[model samples]
Target: MNKTGKIYVVGIGPGSKEHMTFEAKTAIEKSDIIVGYKTYIDLIKDMLEDKEVASSGMKKEIERCTEALEYAKQGKTVSLVSSGDSGVYGMAGIMFEVAFKDESHVEVEVIPGVTAANAAAASLGAPIMHDYVTISLSDLLTDWSLIEKRLHCAGKGDFVVCLYNPKSKGRQQQIQIAREILLKYKNEDTVVGIVRNAKRAGESIVITTLGDMLKYEIDMFTTVIVGNSNTYSVKEKMITPRGYEL
Candidate 1:
């Protein structure tokens, strides 16, 4: 093992080549090794020509981070890649966690990128324009009780709610639970928008209502925007006023 090793936890933005920031590109181009999940690896495949790449798929996040640590320990400048912002439910946190546990590994530098929340908000006009609370409906890392509590709190506070990981193959009821929680403070006609595969090919924006969300097919790739009591749709675009109007 050499001694000049450093780890860069790079955010590749969402999924588009154009979304890849200049700083991210520079880091990848300069890295001695690139490590990430398979999807993230595929997303930046072209940028990794002639670069040593180690990609993991369907493995526990700790396992992936451990591999990245091993690569970095070998004195290789490594880039740990994550789709969307690396810190937004992404790999940056886990990588740092591993580093902290092992003093032999140096601290990691996290490079921020545009998260899905930002991209989804852009695609859906301004659904998250004002005060909004972003939450993930996935119960993997968080408990359902906490998610429900946040959903109700966000609804009562009239904050636009941005939901991530709304649905997946085995987890299907969390979104419905979230919908029920929001319905207490939101009207059935309250506008809700769904942005799937944001900034990627096959991107789509669906604007509907609190009641209509159940009728739509949602997946892990989707980002759901549930409007507050004051949210509305104009010209078929969802817009939540930030209260900046005079």
Candidate 2:
């Protein structure tokens, strides 16, 4: 009987090897096949030499995960790559779901990496030193009304909010709506940090107020962090005090 192969869900972390965790890299190195979105695969293409690569475009996540599972069942070690932490809006969940439903007895391991929130926060100093919530404005799978409710709750709770997939060409108004919803609870002067292409090429960091964040350029590659009431900006760095009584 052939041994069932293993699958490793690896997070690449901000499209740069420097930001990727050692474990993530190791899984890719050990895998016989690497599968991921084309953009993410390109980010680490150099390391994938002599390896079988299966890449697809956006919205093909289900196809990608299914392919990885198929490869694993065929006794091939597979690495499913995702940008940022795999468990955070990445491929890990879908992979597990597919595996469970199919009852594929393949060994699976999830290797975490620097998620967008962490990478964006580090780029603009510590804006989430206290309680925070990470929300994605993309309504691809989630309902818009549900997202609004989450935004409203995050605002009312005064939790530092990290927004992913803030905007894109076809979906532009969601970010604006998010800003308006957050403004209902957060003051106009609340610090907002925007980090684009974080830890990768063409990286840009903006420290602005929630009232003026929309004025700056934002897109899918950007991560926006809205500071809590206690958060502030000093010397161009956004900081949220942890209330250590200093």
Candidate 3:
């Protein structure tokens, strides 16, 4: 039989087995080897206990992809895992980049999963119901100035904004900067919802206002959802009506 020299770049979704898709599970079940970030692999340690696993740390993305590709080239099925949707800030793009540059002929599959924005929105009770835009405050690969420009546009358009990587140890001021820019276009009372570790253990959900958003603690695990000009907070929910009139 011809070797199934293929690599599956799968999204496991929010680090919970329940949130993981059947397609993702099946792909990993079929794969002979699995490679991903150490945190991601640890999330499913029990499920992948018997599989040949190669785990990488925070910044070694290229090395992880290269290892997966090399394993596939040896006629082994490899599942390269990512936390959220493989296409969104995940390993799928990296795998494709490596594959194209090296002209590797291995078959590649990309599976989608829930991203932090969507997961946090759901936990916050539909803050993303209206027109919304997602922006990551992390400037590792993107420039802070460009991110600020996008924030400005979202503010002018009154788009509900979902922010990823709001604050980390090294970069702590971007969230405050984002709030300042949005305040120019949005009200100080605009509703804001903060979700940390969505759908995972020790998850935390906090509802705040644009005026006092900075008073709360934020980190890489947190996702901040800012409502549009029309968004409202009632009881325990942050909701943006989809312009449907009763």
What clash count goes with each model?
1, 0, 0
Which parts of model 2 have CA positions greater than 4 angstroms off? none
lDDT of 1 by residue, 146-211 (tens): 888988889899888999999999997888888988989889999999989998989988999999
Candidate order by lDDT, decreasing, is: 2, 3, 1
How many angstroms is residue 165 displaced in model 2 relative to the true structure, after the best TM-score fit? 0.5
Global fold similarity of model 3 (TM-score): 0.97
Candidate 1, 234: how far from true, in Å? 1.4
Give the TM-scores of the predictions, in the order they appear: 0.95, 0.99, 0.97
Indicate whether candidate 1 or candidate 2 has the larger lDDT: 2
Locate the minimum summed-lDDT window of 10 residues in model 2: 1-10
Clashing pairs in 1: 13-84
Task: Name the top lDDT candidate.
Answer: 2
- Candidate 1 residues lying further than 4 Å off, grouped into runs, are none
> Where is model 3 poorest over a 10-residue stretch in terms of lDDT?
1-10
Higher-TM-score candidate of 2 and 3: 2
